[model samples]
Target chain A: MEKKKEMVKTKRAQKKDNKWTQNDKVFLYILIPILILFFVFNTLQLLKGFYYGLTNYKGYGDYSFVGLRNFIDLFSDARVGKSYVFTFKYAIVLTIIVNIISLILALGLNKEIKGKSVLRGIYFVPNILGGLVVGYIFSFIFTYILPAIGQMAGITFLQNSILASTKSAWIAIVIVGAWQGIAMNTIIYISGLQTVPEDVYEAGMIDGATGWEKFCKLTFPLILPFITINLVLCMKNALMVFDQIMSLTKGGPSQSTESISYLIYNNGMSGGQFGFQSANAFVFFVVIVIVSFLQMKFLGGKEEQL
Target chain B: MSENMEKVTKEAVEGAVTNENEGEAFAKKRRAKHKKQSGPVQGKTVNRVINILLALGCLTVLFPLYMTTIIAFKQPSEMTNDISGALGFPAEWKFENFTEAMRVTDFWHSLGNSILITGVTVALCILIHSLAGYVIGRKMIKLKAFKMSYYYIVSGMFVPFAVLMMPLVKQTAQIGIANRFGVIVLYTVFFMPMNVMLYTGYLKNIPTQLEEAAHVDGATAWQTFWKIIFFNMKPMHATVAILTAMSTWNDVMTPLVIMAGTDENTLPLAQLNFQSQFGTNYNLAFASYLLALLPILIFYIVCQKQILSGVVNGAVK
Candidate 1:
């Protein structure tokens, strides 16, 4: 009798599980709408972007499909090449500068200091301001204030506007980018520092570890994950640089500062090279994917080793 | 009574002896040892040096803002070509610059547009993404379909917005939504991958037993989610709201493309459009920039604690 009852209970449970439940209804109710919107907005657009790359369709009128010609053209185009070179260079430099400054700021702020929160708030102010506005503000400084100071101090380099020169224009962008970029990165690092337990520092002290030694041995290893996060975030943001370039240089000084995104927006959308820029955008996408994948593999390996 | 009084006095004496011998002496020794150990790490000199460095850092960060404020108050005539003209306070405060800036940018209209866009985008992101996250988070463990869907959604994170820019413009125009409405929808969609990841990760810590209990008590899945699970995800909501709001508020590209040729303009868009018109009129331009910055700056100031913590939480996850 006991065996029969157990078998019957199992059969009932299986029946209930197989039957459509209210949970499934709720799940579909939520999932279907999101999937629909996702399809219409994201997935569909991506596929269309890929298709647009193969054609010579301008923004307005239709045109014949250009096949692999656009993609082929991307190889020999000097402007495209220049942009890629500029973008990669900017991304690398900005990433390094931002990480270093933010890390140092984080370390200092993590100490017991008066008005720590207030100081942090001040630093983070730039991050909250719109990029365009910040760009405009800094543009004025680069144009007016810096030059004035330069003239007053009799510094030849400072007397002229940096944005007007191709060689120094990119550096100005990096400075502004780093100024805003450091804020969030610093906050991330501080949080990482907070995660290192007091006991670990105590143990380090007991073992006669110096301040630098403790940071290197104890704090750095514990915060490796945060470093990876910051690095990846910083790299991705740097590569897609747009707004500051727009307001500051307009990709001018002979298009020396045209990032990949800026190029796409300028040429593809407004400049009526939609199909060609689409191909460029597609290539840019693949580059981002490969770069991100490599970063993950490299950084993820380091994280594991630590 | 005399016997009881004598016993109490003896116990008090014993307590005092134990406190002095064990507690006070040990505390003093530990305090001294702590000071000795922390001397190098937390020395007065080291702290003072760090503080001085930090103060300098703050000044550097504030320098541009200070310049902007001073320049905005100075007249075009007072804005001489020299450093003193740039650095010194305006001879007389020119509050008219702000009025001119407001008039030029249609400041109130664009401000409203920005607030509306940000508010709606944040609300929709929280609502749709959290529900999607909860469902995926709960069911992905048992269902293969849910797991695949989760991956499908999360993969959007790696795709850069530039790749989608041109195509999205054409698509939105085709769909007849290439306006502020379209921008809001796109913002919600753009933020989904990161927000969903955050939400699903948060949901893992919420115990399944609560849902099971609700099920046993004859509550429907909808009721269970709304009543129990939704409220449990407040911190994650704050994280999503803050991250989405910041990006949406400060964003320029989406509004620029989507709302092109429309009468509507977000704050950033207005500033960009009027930039050339305000060219060389540093006072008006600076005033306009400050006006554009004020809303988000004030928001940040009021919610600094939550905003900072929210960013940390979102980034770490």
Candidate 2:
């Protein structure tokens, strides 16, 4: 009779297992379709895109396996090289200017001041705008208003559209970029400021630390993680600047402001070199991946050390 | 003897109370000292200068947007002289500039397309991502292979759309969805991973006890998800919705590539074409920019509080 009872218990456990299997089945049926869709569109396409980098073709149709030929062409292509160089310069300048201005704004606004809330909203307005609109608006400013203002003030540098020249084009891009980018970074800095506890400041004061010393020792370390996050975000954005460049400068005055992203889009879609552009995209992606990895590692280590 | 003992005890209690008050006062004085040490030290002139500088910075930031507004309203003849300062209202305001912009862009049709595409994409993206997030965060954690897929999707965040544009264009065309609807599919596909990251991150923190209970009540998985889990994800829902909506509304490249030969055009694309077609007509171009900008501004104004709080909360965590 005891053996019979043991067998019966095993049967009941098996039945419970069967029930869970039934639920798993239902779950799989629900999930599989979405999974398939995601796979086919994103994962599958990503692999296929990488494959095109190894071949030679126009924007469509059959291609021969070229085996690093297109990748070789990427290094030799001066236009692509110029875009990469320009984008890097833009990113470095933007990251510094944006972080500084936003941090200053955060410091100023973090004080016990009146109208701080309203001022924050007003400051954040540019971020609410799409890049295209902001770009176009800034384009008009550069192409017309600034020139007119320059004429009025007798300033030689601003007599023509800054975007019309290679030297000034980058400066224009940086300005427009910072104009919009500062809002998000400022908000981020404010949030970061909020996280650094008030007691720490009191401690700094107790140590008789100067304002600059207190900031360097206390606030900066506390907000290091935020800086890292913002830096990475800023770098990525600066690197991928397409809309503003397209609208404001159109990568003009000799393709001086053409970013890698713009280069990929132009070459792949409109420039009629499918495999070559694909190779450019792959390299671009690899560079992005490496920089992103470095960013996380470099800052993540600092954050942990802090 | 009893009276003397009572008086001594009362005196002791009073002494303790006085000591405690003294200690509290000392702590308050210390706090005040810290404040006095760290508080602002700028003289009146310095303070005034800083405030003036900040105000000036605000004006400088506002310059381009201000120009867009004034230039949009000014007649063509006024453009040259009115460029002196960016702030003044036009003497002859061209309200018809908006009408002209609207006519040039085929505003109503493009607006309809944008609304349909963005709305449907946002809704579908939310549903699919939330469901996927729920499953991954809750159920799939136990299965190693399934957990790997979770990581895979998360890794997709690093790859920009430009990387896959080559194959993606062909793939969409192969399926014969290379138009307005195709653009929607791309948004849904590309925008999924971020929202999934968000939702899954959120759902991981939400305990499964309630869901388990719903399961115990003989509710099917579908019923339990709809009745209990989906409603509980309101904050994630809002973040995903607003983000997806904004990007879809503002997007130009995706539509430009997929629907280049097609008749369909979203507002941003329409605006771009309008600007080009009316090239050098600053008034109409400025007006077109404002018109493209108007809906977003209204959306911001309407949902300002929620958007701000939601964005801050979402990113902060």
Candidate 3:
């Protein structure tokens, strides 16, 4: 009788296990198809970009592989040349200014002040607005507000325009980009700042450290990780910017302000040089991947200290 | 009774002797120090100065929007000659610019296209990404190897939309979904990483025990998820939905690149087209841009609290 009872219990447990296995199998069947669709589609989309880069193909059905011809043409293309210069210049300027301004805002809000949250809200409001809307508003500001300010300052030449010239157009783009990005970056920096323990600050103060000393030693060093994350992401994003430029400048004043992405877009879609755009895009992809990889590696090395 | 009372009094006297004098002096000095620190009715001067400076900076940031609002309402002559006058609240408010802009830009069709595309994109992205996010977040599932796939997807965020636009356009042409909801779906794929990150991060904090319990209580996996896990992820859902909506609704690039040569242009692209139509008409262009931004701004304002709270809360977590 005892043997039979044990056998029954074991069999029942086995049956439950079988039921679970069946349930899991059913779940997997339902999920795997969807997962594969997304994965396969996205992977193909990305990989095809690279594959198409090497081809001397047009939009139609037929094409042949042309090894590095697209790249060679890319280097020689005057439009691509202008875009490269403009994009790099804009990225550098925008990255540095945005970081500094956001960091400053973060530090300011980090202090024990009244209405700090409200101040934060006010600053971050622009970020919530769509980039296109922000671009549109900036267009008017460039056309209208800056001129008025210039007039008030008695600077007649500056009063005449804000974004007509190549140099001025670049400046306007950077300023608008910085404005749009500052709020989120400020929030990220603030998040970083909060990680500095109060006791650490007190300890610094106990050592007779001044405010600046405390910030430089305790705050800045501690926030390096956040800085890295913010910097890399910002740099990558600024490099790939399109909407605002397309809206505000449209690579205007003779394509003086056209970035790589904008150039790729205009050439491929409007100009119908599909394969040429693909090559430009592939180069952009490689550049992004390399830069991001290096950034990750550098940060990875510092992760030990963090 | 008298002898006991006398003994108690003596002990109390000794206790007072030991404790009172030092305590009294400490309290007196502390009170004196507090009094000295408390100056009569003065505010924090440093805070005031700092706040004033910050307010000024914030105003400068907002100055562009303020000026635009003014310009969108002004007359063409005002816009041309006196940019300042154009950039002020009209002395006599004219709402006709908005009407004129709508009529001139075929605003209805453009608005409808934007709504359809953005709505479809947000819905599909949320659905697909949440499923993927859930799979990644719920590691108890047998598909544990899929976490690497999620990481791969996350890295896709770094791929510039430009890099993919060319091939994406071509691929869309092949798939025959280029101009319509195809661009919308592709946008979802491209933009999924950020939304996935948000969802997965949120899901991590939720204990798996809830779903397990629901499962053990004879619920199917789907039921357990929808009934238990999904219901619990309100904050994450709000954040993702609002953000996805905002981005898709505002996106010009995808429509510009993919939807080109088609009549399926969204609001931002329509605005671009509007610019072409009335390129030289500064008033009409400005007015159209304002019209494009208004509905979005309204939506954002209405959802502002939820969006801000969701982000702030997510950050805290």
Candidate 4:
């Protein structure tokens, strides 16, 4: 151990001594090609996406530069507007519900429960299946099983599949999204809970704190960082939610369940309006960046204060 | 007894005589009570209630999966039959539904395409991400440009691929790369940011001694990295590989837009086609879902420990 530390120190010294060397050139040789490939394939394509948003480009053939025309149409496009609203609602609802429920599950598992591991594994099992498959599974449950059970038991609301209605479709999406996405947040919360030292809880107990009180005063504040990470992640996933929505509703009973990603997909790929869809895609990217940034700044600053 | 001894020893060391007698008596009562049952009666009841609730929640989560498996085995006619509730086991299990669905899906060709695409994507993803992560992390070149390039790639993670993909629809058409190999290339470049993040965090922790020792032995930089640094990166690489591989395997939109309506069918696309082909046979549809699910489920069951830890680590970043 001592020798390792000493050797690391000398390496640091060597770095300062030589600054840059002919030997250092080898790393650049490896780095440059990867950088070039990324720039051409991923980053350059993003730049092209931005450029296409300003033009009259279709899927192919001829095009002309129609400055700001696509962006102008974006304002009046009723479907695009509805999708943005739906995406926001889905993101907000799913993030809040999933985090709350996941926190509860994490706290429950942290307690003195018999078969804690078994219960946790079961809760996390859905996460192993893709969002696509889980959506299909629940589609059957909602359409065939739940309604049949409801009809057999004389429950009117349950007898009608939730996906058939707009209001209930929102809830159904949350249910499926929460099922597939909750496990990771729960795991993260468990890890965050474990980080709170035992002595901290002991001190709280010494002052006669109740369970809810300890959670409010100690656990929540300490776990704020984990909460932020999970929140941002859930928000992003909910915003991009495509596979599940496609499998569950196919944006139907009348295009009511179409998310923003689905909107871009249907417009660009199916509708053959490449340039116009690229404009919508550009706005979607900006909205995500802004929302995530604002969330991180607000919550992240609060985290430091705690 | 362990609890009692700990409390007694702590009190003795503190020299705090206040409540010392009460503490000892309480410890004895606790030890005696421990032999009869665990904890207070009220707390036990509360815990039992919580456990039962948790168990119910687990069942609720597993219900859909349970339904899929049960119905997948039932004959097509049994779906509407009234022998029992839909949740009940099939009276007549027609496993032939799976074989029929398999035939319609061109299961062999679709499975081959999925394997080839995912296999090549994961191999290339690991190669580039690790190679880049290593050089940038170790600062072997000691240049500001390399670090800037690192953040440049990391920035791609925030821009939703939904938007990035819009232009590719046209561009790939123009270039005529929207085939099986085309989607493979997209997955390769698309997944780099995440892989790099994981590898960078890992590579930063490694000590410089191994590389320096190799240097002293007259080893070339390639030889040292391939032989020494790569071994230490195995666990992180496995984490990255499993995660990216699963996403690529389950991917639907990519193959749908790029490779669909052609002979180059990925599993999800094939399953989608199967739904249309056997529109009325719910049995066959469920069978296809199961077949589509089986491969990834098996992989996950085998590598779950690595996967769970990978998720936590990747998110905690």
**Residue B281 local lDDT, model 3:** 70
Task: Report the C-alpha lDDT of model 1 over B1-317, residue by residue, as the tens digit.
Answer: 22332343344345445544544455565577576864753355455456656766776666777777778778888877777778677888668999999999999999999999999999999988999899999888777778898999998998888899999998889889999999999998999999999999999899886886676667887788889999999989999999999999999999998899689999999999898776768889888888887788778879999999999888888
lDDT of 1: 0.86
lDDT: worst 10-residue window of model 3 chain B: B38-47
DockQ scores of the candidates: 0.54, 0.38, 0.34, 0.51
Top-down DockQ ranking: 1, 4, 2, 3
lDDT of 4 by residue, A1-306 (tens): 677567657766777887675567888787888888788778787889989999888867788998999999998999999999888998898999999999999998877888877666667767767777678878877887778778878999988899999778878888899888888789888888887889988899889887799999988899889999899888888899999887888887677888999888887876868889999999888888899889888888878333
lDDT of 4: 0.79
Candidate order, lDDT descending: 1, 2, 4, 3
Stretches of candidate 1 off by over 4 Å are A1-22, A304-306, B1-42
Q: Per-residue lDDT of A1-306 in model 2, one digit per residue for the tens?
A: 566556555754765665445666676677678778888888897778778888887876777999989899889999989999999999999999999999999887776654567667767878778888788888877877788889889999999889898899999989989998898888888888998888888888889987799899899999998898789888998988888888888888799999888888988887878888888888888898899999988888887233
Q: Each prediction's TM-score against the native?
A: 0.91, 0.88, 0.84, 0.89
Residue B166's lDDT within candidate 4 is 72
Residue-by-residue lDDT tens digits, candidate 1, A30-60: 7988988988889888888889999998888
Q: TM-score of model 3, chain A?
A: 0.87
Q: Give the better candidate number (1 or 3) by lDDT.
A: 1
Interface RMSD (Å), each candidate?
Answer: 2.6, 3.7, 3.6, 2.4
Candidate 2, which segments miss by more than 4 Å at Cα?
A1-25, A304-306, B1-52, B85-88
The residue pairs in collision within model 1 are none
Task: Give the per-residue lDDT digits (tens) of candidate 3, residues A1-306.
Answer: 566556555754775665445555655555566556656557776788878878877767688899889989988999888898899888888889989999988888877666777667768777766677678667866876678778888987678566898668888899888988787678878888888878987788679886589778888888887788778767887898888887788889779989898888887776767788888888888888887898888875663243
After best superposition, candidate 4 residue B76: deviation in angstroms? 2.1
Which model scores highest in TM-score?
A: 1
Off by over 4 Å in 3: A1-24, A60-62, A76-78, A144-162, A300-306, B1-43, B140-144, B309-317
